[model samples]
Target: MHDLIVSPFLDGFLAVRPGSPACVRLPTDLYEEVRAGADNTVPAWLVQTAADAWSLDLDGKAARSALLVREPTELAFARASWEINLYCNFGCKHCYLGERPLAGLSWDDKVKLIDIFRDSGVLWLQITGGEPTVDPDFEGAYRYAYRQGMMLTVSTNASRLWKPDLLRLFRDCPPYRVVVSMYGATEESFDELTQRKGAWKNFRKLMAAARNAALPLRVSIVVTDDNAHEVDAMKAVVQGWGLDHHVYTNMQPTFSGEGDPLLVQSTEFLRKRPVFEGCNAGVTFFHADPHAKVSICKIGRDDQIDLMTEGIDGLRRLGEISDRLMLRTGGCTGCSLSGSCRVCRPLAKVYQEAKAPLGMYCQHGDTKEMVHP
Candidate 1:
């Protein structure tokens, strides 16, 4: 049977034989319809293809392996993300970690953190930061995780991926993938958004070095109003470079409690999405911030407790707290739009109130239209 991999947010998917190089990134519309399943609008051939590969009946009624939702906390948490620190060398105007005193778990503390994740049954680790490359202890941390047999997924700006120390270390202990965030298409637009001179040059340098070494690299372009004009150009450039990439439009609230959607894309550009229903966060997947605060996800930071103080049972204890905080208030519960509403408690906190539909609702009237990958 073939294995299907679908991203809930990125609007892309890959279907491949689990251990072989046989894979295809399905077209967006086909992926969406297959993900939609019963309520799919596509022709029967597409659904039939998906079912045959995933070993489902021709009707496509059976849940796709990629779409199956796993429940439970500690016992099932094989995927987790660790925000090493919110420190970065470059200044991006749209950063959620906005200008804060750099604070993070020390080397020993981080090692302990890694152990905690492993003990909690984590098998896939996501290493992210304001820029993970900026951390001195990153190599040690990465090595420790690697030795534990956890598949690593790193997020970086590609600024220091070319360093002899890092290149050698990662070359020896390679991650499953490394994602580089692209700010803009041109040097001028790059500097305009990132506010760093010569950063464009540095990025190119790292790119060249990485290409020469043949590193497993992918690109993620943060779609924003400022760089909207260059989105096509950026995608073209990355594609021309023989890179696989995806574009994300959401600009979340700042880490400083500033509910500013500063870098949000224009309404015309953002794909209309249905209100989010369930998430993998906290249940099967989780997030650990720089200060050891464990939360459901990045946007769910405010709803989290301190991991160091709360211990491994942090999420278990936070159940009641989440229940209480998730109670619908204001016009949301009473409004007819509540059922179709895509805004959840975590994202709701980003605005002045929980009520949404600010034209952000899904294009299709039903929740089935929601694209996972």
Candidate 2:
């Protein structure tokens, strides 16, 4: 029920609103004072500051319902992404998930998982799936995470964005952002790409509803051989809606090392990725699959920690796991171009396992031939 959350962030303390991006960093002493202060009571100065920062009319004696102060923890995480379920209504050939199964934690277990995220100090949580919005317990899980004071982002296909219940939930408690994937600019191409009829109609409704509700929406233009021809048209459509968008040109093999998804790659639209600089991954962030199995990152699923059994304490091993995963061993060992490799070790391993063409991910491939003029 709190409107503001003050929690330990990295080496400092940060104050953030649940649905908003604006954050205020508090000094260590101030954070300690807030934590040690009487229950439901915040400093008068903070109350005034919060009111001004978020434009809320806070009482002089800030109640616990208005402000939440989380105790400091040994956990270093500030962000995490969870796959609530792996089910989807549309079957896109380029999907990396490959198989779409309706499986996830129970509602009771889901509540526990959300609590674990809070206890582990996850501030920014992304709710994703084959299609997150279509999950049966999506509403319950989303609401619980929101109430727990985690800033959320939902990744979806926008097929169900126009649903009345979903609209009401988002209107009441907006997500940090709703990231929708754009398959095509026209109905025919859209349905063709998703292999689902009426998908375009649903997408149009989703856009209109989101615009009318004034929701924070961003688009991911997914370019594949099927929809590559509509790339410009897709951008124009999103631009007309006055929404921000990012183009995703590269397609990868499926998580299970299947090369089928690679076949759909739009070589003309493919963009070169930057060199792989080390990422925080398991150090500061981790990914949880539908079964609550934790991995350093989405691509590196080896040596997973079962959150359901190990609980939050399980995250302790992630740092070491991350270090080991980043090592240039296995298929990457003795490679001369490792320094300039665009993909991470884990992703490269996936490509190697699938026997994917070097042209798809390796710099040794002819870049000039792949890039469009």
Candidate 3:
């Protein structure tokens, strides 16, 4: 039998309420305490004793294990991201949000957003947009998220990041991390991808300044047919930074959609790569849009019930959404690749629009290989 594995989050609590099934292992003393509504504390010795009593597994090993179960909070790591707006200044060829530039968010709305996220009980918030910095009240919104104890991460072009005060603000009030998309490693390539001249210089200067400030940074590289050949080179560049990089395979062509046009690769190109066959949206993680609309993940967002209004309680309502509408249910059952399926809600949306075969719809082709490798 496969050994059991435990998640770190289970370290202290005997029970975890992740908006769904709670994992509980009853110990007589603990159960009594809980029944009495006592301020029960789980000590290390108690945990070891309980594990011994249950013979639980640890991390797929035969050692001690922590009680764990699939739940909404566990899904998506229980983190929350609010796509404040879709409008971005640079209308790149591969944007998923499909937001228009110059269409900024209102100040009153920004205040309300702070309250919404703060009240949601989610301690993580991401401010994204066409260009979040472009928001008229961008600083105010950011300060609000910070004041509320929500860790912040900004996905940006880094054009205005050169501003000293802004850099100081981020370095002093550092969030968990900031992710910047580097279209290309060089000037010509980057300019081509962003369709904005001088963008490369701006990125280079800002990244250097951020490095000086010791800001936590992550880089994402979008792989496409146009730049597929450069994957190896990009990997080298990412390695040079001594930081991990994320590479996304281009989404497949869509019949008609609001998303950017894709650089469709051939079937051979996809098959020659690694294979991932299962999806972990509702099971491992979930995605929510700007309005708190929930999707199993980005791939299925267009198809799931809105959770903002319904709250976490709405997941049960998926039972009524009909299997036919849930594409993965029909295509994924018992598939050998089920464990590694890369399909997510956003990718699923692309598939629905392109009607492309499942293999062709992922952001990066069917593999989790380190791009640099």
Candidate 4:
């Protein structure tokens, strides 16, 4: 397996180490030189540069086939998020995927989907789920994507992280990051929030194992009404474990426009988001559901492109779709606060459809002036 991945990133090329965050930008001429080098060998200067960046000695004459993998396309995407399956072990109240259906593409089809992702220029792929690790073909898919030179981020619940086979796989080919969601601080609150008995115990055991193995891990502190009081305790727990964490208090309506999740929102913990800025979703990134249906992003699922049928060419239409979906329409039509709106148009539409309070997503709401508690 190659330790370095040379891939087209946006308008340029990047040489990055698998399982590491370090990257080096290669100029057009250097990229062409590497691609056209004799016997697919890495140049001496690049070897020394990579050694300096990673603090590891490398063979100057290493065959490119042995030391690196290059992406085959210039029209590559910078990032993508894929929901391998919607199936999840935990039934949390604040989950945006409300239905929690047990469904996804078969192994053969999944392989095809990954190929499309690779061919379409996906460099950084986030494998998520209703809990991605629980998928039956997750290991196969993960190994395949890693081999394809795509840096991966697994968004999991940490329930299955302790499995010996999984630990070995991660040790052999580490993901760029494993994002685990922390439901609550205490076992009682944790299990109650997920509505799954023994979940807290399983999570604790797996987290310890993962830490012992030195796997790259980050924590997302999910704050809801049930665990609102334990927010501080949650932070302390993560800190004690020596893991980086981010607090997430805002709860969105379900993909189908249901407001059930909004009921669990902890108003006290809600933090104001930064000002709305333009995003590269669909232009530089995209989201894919289990069945290989591509959308602008997780939040905007309209006009999905069927990658399984239409193939990668289907993505060409997303640029147009992104523009249309971002228009200030429906409830937001003619809104005076459009310039300073925090939520994007598609997300705002979902909130409006669910009849969510303006205070939750709108700057013009009565609670817009709320301060962090």
Could you tell me which 10 consecutive residues in candidate 4 have the lowest summed lDDT?
364-373
**In model 2, which runs have C-alpha deviations exceeding 4 angstroms?**
38-42, 59-61, 366-373
What alpha-carbon RMSD in Å does predicted model 1 have with respect to the real structure? 12.0
Global Cα RMSD, each model: 12.0, 3.3, 10.9, 3.2
155-181 per-residue lDDT for model 3 (tens digits): 787777878878866755565677777
Clash counts for all predictions: 6, 0, 22, 0
Query: Which regions of candidate 4 deviate over 4 angstroms?
Result: 38-40, 72-74, 367-373
- Give each model's whole-structure lDDT: 0.66, 0.87, 0.53, 0.87
Model 4 C-alpha lDDT per residue in residues 1-373, reported as the tens digit of each score = 7777777788888888877888899888887777777475677877787789887556755655645546557456778999999999999998989787779999999999998888888989999999998999999999999998889999999999999999998988879999999999888889989999998988899999999999889999999989999999999999999999999999998988788999998888888988788788899899999889999999999899999899888988989999999998876779889999998988888888787878888888885353121
Q: What C-alpha lDDT, on a 0 to 100 scale, does residue 110 get in candidate 1?
A: 85
What would you estimate as the lDDT of candidate 2?
0.87
lDDT of 2 by residue, 46-111 (tens): 878788899866666655667777776778688999999999999998898988899999999999
Candidate 3: what lDDT?
A: 0.53
State the lDDT of candidate 1 residue by residue for 1-373, as single tens digits: 1123332222334443221223456666655565566343334664566566655343443444323211122344657898897888878776877674567888888887887777666656899998887877888999887765466788998889779988887677666788899988878878777889877888888988887777778999877776888889999988988989988776655655453454355555676556567566666667888877887777666567787776777756544554554555532446566666666756655543322334443223444332221
lDDT for model 1, on a 0 to 1 scale?
0.66
